[model samples]
Target: MRETLRVQLWPLPTLGVALAAVAGVGLPQLDARIQLDPPTWLKTYLFSGGPDAARSVLSAIAGSLVTVTALTFSLTVLTLQLASSQFSPRLLRTFTADRHVQATLALFLTTFTFALTVLRTVRTGKDEQTEFVPQISVTVALLLTLASLLALVLFLSHLARELRIETMMRSVHSATVHTIHRLLPQQQDTAGRDSAAGNASGATPEPPANALPLTVSASGFLTSMDEKALLRAAVEADAVVLIDRTPGDSLVAGTPVGVAWPRPGTHLSSEARARLVGRAAAAVSIGPERTDREDVAFGIRQLTDIATKALSPGINDPTTAVHALAHSSALLCELAGRDLGPRMLHDDQQRLRVVLRRPDLDELVTLAVAQPLRYGAGEPAVLARIAALLRELAWTAPPDRHPPIAGALARLRSTIDGQDLDDTEHVRLVELTRLAEEALAGRWPPGR
Candidate 1:
């Protein structure tokens, strides 16, 4: 036979009921009409008595302590879980989100409710006749309330500090992406184009622009268990893993792991790309060995697949239209040889930061222009006719729409007919093409 053990958590309403009964009946009845001025020790023993007292004052204290401890632990666990949940991401996305305020108010209300029950129970007299009603001093009530509130604030403040450290980790990830993108060739293209144009118009060139250097930092408790394996994986990926320079040798945030480095040159060999993809696949396979690094490695693998597919053919296999749009956006950045998507993986803030650096519309249009010319050059007239349909499917929209790719094709036609390329026009075209790709491919972006 198996034995089962159960633990009962005290209910809050029970505390309230016990307090009311003690104040309204028990304490009052005991104190009523006694009229004897007891010594300090005697009074203390009667009110704040040992376990053997008639009302068992020590038992009440023990129960209250257990209840309060359980409540506090529950609340702390709930607050931390809430902070880390998917809801937290949505909440953070909202303009008015404030975890600190929410947590503090929750803690305060919970503590205050317990304090109120305790005060009510304490103020009831221990005499039989007075048990009908207990006298509570205003000063005592206020003091209890104030003490509970103070304790709540202190507890919540400590929780807030933990939350701050998490927030900083996210910030560091965002900063790393921002810095890396600043150093890439695609990032300098706009300025380079403008400078060349200015030179053609016989103007002096601007000063040499300072390139943003990629700085890797990381922080958190890293234990001894899998450090060597993690370091080996990083080295295999050609990414650098940086640790803090301080005494304890902690991992720093924004520290680029060896696996996250860009491809060595302007173009990767087919064999090299295959190897990189294989490495990413291997990482994904091995990640489940450790729970702590599983999510992080999974995210990295997803990003790697996106980057690989964007640069090379035969990699786009998203499951949904929205996912395709996100993948295409990331892929477009990769094709333009930009680092925006990788940044998004590193930091949540990169979602917005990526939009700032407009994608190269011309490159996307060039891809659109080439699809038909490469695949459908010499067939029967009707078969050739469907080539346009196929091209539209590949470049403009998914195959299931009413007019299939008509709307997107029309938009591209307008761009082709001679609209001056501005940042807005480029971004719009990129978005449209990405949506089209997504509709066909069924892929959504990270954090969508």
Candidate 2:
């Protein structure tokens, strides 16, 4: 339920439909109330009219709205298709996460709903009975229709802007940085006070030989799990639990995704172990594909895919590859300065309640840009950009963190040594490589 709401596909549209229904049902009462007791002040704004004019306007709105809604849906889907084919299919996740597109659909539906509902409230001259019209409701419906049309125009303009590669890159960049900040804990929390306490006290223990193995039955990406709930369940059962699968891990049926061991010398019965695994599994959520909501590696994968596509022989777009490396390098550099958060979490009684698995800084750097490095080494533009990136990281990160990025830079240098580039081109790349070496060595440039 929580994951569904967090990654809601049509959340805004669903609410808009409900709100339109409410407006359709309630606005007519407002008209009736006005007619029953006309406020002298509000009378000037009150619509004093008949079904002849209002019904005709509403009918027009209703017809136009249907056509416009279908057109918008088609255009939006086409835009997504183009983006996926030209850029990266991984980017399709961004389109699903967009609220504006959802709002466009909602507005179109709301306009049609409001107009049709108002038309039903109005009737023309009858042969034997009386005719009535909700003048105020119909007027409001017209206003809403006009508003919807204006919104549709804006939506079209925004959709065009969104399709531009620059806008998409900016969105991807911001999301990656935000994800880093959210998922990477502060150094003090991970390796400082709490870490020292746990390390000194020998709080965390190894899993027992008889520890129960919780094989994941479902096969998919493990998107998320309720950490608190898992911890609470473990605490209640006096069990120490360690999850082998992280949010981004792919699970195969009957694979050990986690382990549960009873406290110290205690032995939990089979029924108890079975119940614990059931509760733990219930708190975990899995999906067919990765989601940005909890899958920490998804952002890196998207950026890397973009760079890989850019560097592909068919596309041959080195500048785009360089840009992607800049972002990936920045992420890795930032990560280098922070302590990778604690894997073992202890409860109030100093017993390990939950154990987490996360990628280390070296692994993250490898995952983020390794593909592009492997593919783009021959491109001078790509190598220079990455060299500059390495220089930036080498200076900003601690001394120990240099080897991971420096090692990659060394690979670049080795590749350059073997390449058949002209002397002038080779010299330029070597210069960049030299600067990177100096930065990693914590030395200033000659004059500086």
Candidate 3:
């Protein structure tokens, strides 16, 4: 629920509108209650206009604000369209989740709503009633107008900065790094590596001959799983559940996403089987789009999309591709030091209850490297960046995890060999490959 709200543009603005509405209603009544004359200093800040003039002031403020609100909304929509078309559509989440943009829009709409609300209180002498104007409310509306103007300027500058590829890549990288830390923390020791990868606590469980398939009921991306709930269900059913789909994997309706079986010497009754299947299905959440909350690969996917898109013929921008890869390199290097294992949830007696599938280093390395290599094969700069990525990962990865880095470096070498490069470019790439090889061998060369 929180994640859904974060990526939306309406909630904050709606709250702002509600608060403004409340203030608009309550402030007018306060103005009516304060019958005493204000001090000279306080009077100076209050609205001094007569009822007719106050109406004109508020009408003008409300009218101008409506136009400004429309303009702001239009600019925001255009920015979203630009981001979606020029960059990956997945980046639309980043733009929509921007707090500055949301706050600016909220301020504008709130000011407009407040002006309109306060406008109705302005009254001229008529029907034997005295002249009345919400002096304090009108003053606040004026102040808010000034604030909205300043916010508009600041929002323009912020939006411009956000449009840059460097800023976008940095945001994606930061978010990805956060997901990595949350989902795959660094392992201080090699203890339990096998169990971390889904082996049972005592011994590897044989594949149950009567394993019941956990079919996916809806078609969408697997967004999250309630592991505790799944573990509890497995414990209650006296079964072992293996979820083969990771958070970012796409699911088709009615397809088996995993398998569950009763532990050895146990049998599931018909009711228990049905209950287990229902609980297993309910534990997994699917959404129309992927989120990075539990999926580290989503960030890598975004970065790869940017690099590959930049390398496309329509936008032949290799420098941008290199910059994107630099960010990707940081994420991959971080992942190398951490334990990328399938999550295993256990019962009180230390028996594995649930095995959740996750991508290991090799799969993530391929995710971060493959598409860019295929698209940027002819571009020597991109190939060099790929080589550098391997070098960096090689330095961070443990010996057991070096094979993926070496495999990627080998592929980079193959790509560089296929490229039509001048002598200097060829030498640079060859040198990078050699440095990566040295790094893999626990040798550190001097300055890059």
- Write candidate 1's Cα lDDT for 86-160 as tens digits: 112212211112344333443334333433443344423455423311122222233434554565667666556
Which lDDT tens digits does candidate 2 get at residues 50-122?
7688778889999999999989889878987987877799787777677788888888888888888777777
Off by over 4 Å in 3: 36-41, 189-206
Overall local distance difference test of candidate 3: 0.87
Per-candidate TM-scores read 0.23, 0.90, 0.95
**Shift of residue 238 alpha carbon in model 1, Å:** 12
Q: Give the C-alpha miss distance for residue 380 in model 3, angstroms.
A: 0.7
- Give model 2's TM-score versus the native structure: 0.90
Give each model's clash number.
39, 0, 0
Please provide, for model 3 over 170-227, each residue's C-alpha lDDT reduced to its tens digit, 9 standing for 90 to 100.
9999999999887775655435544433333243355576789988789999999998
lDDT of each: 0.33, 0.76, 0.87
Number of the predicted model whose TM-score against the real structure is largest: 3
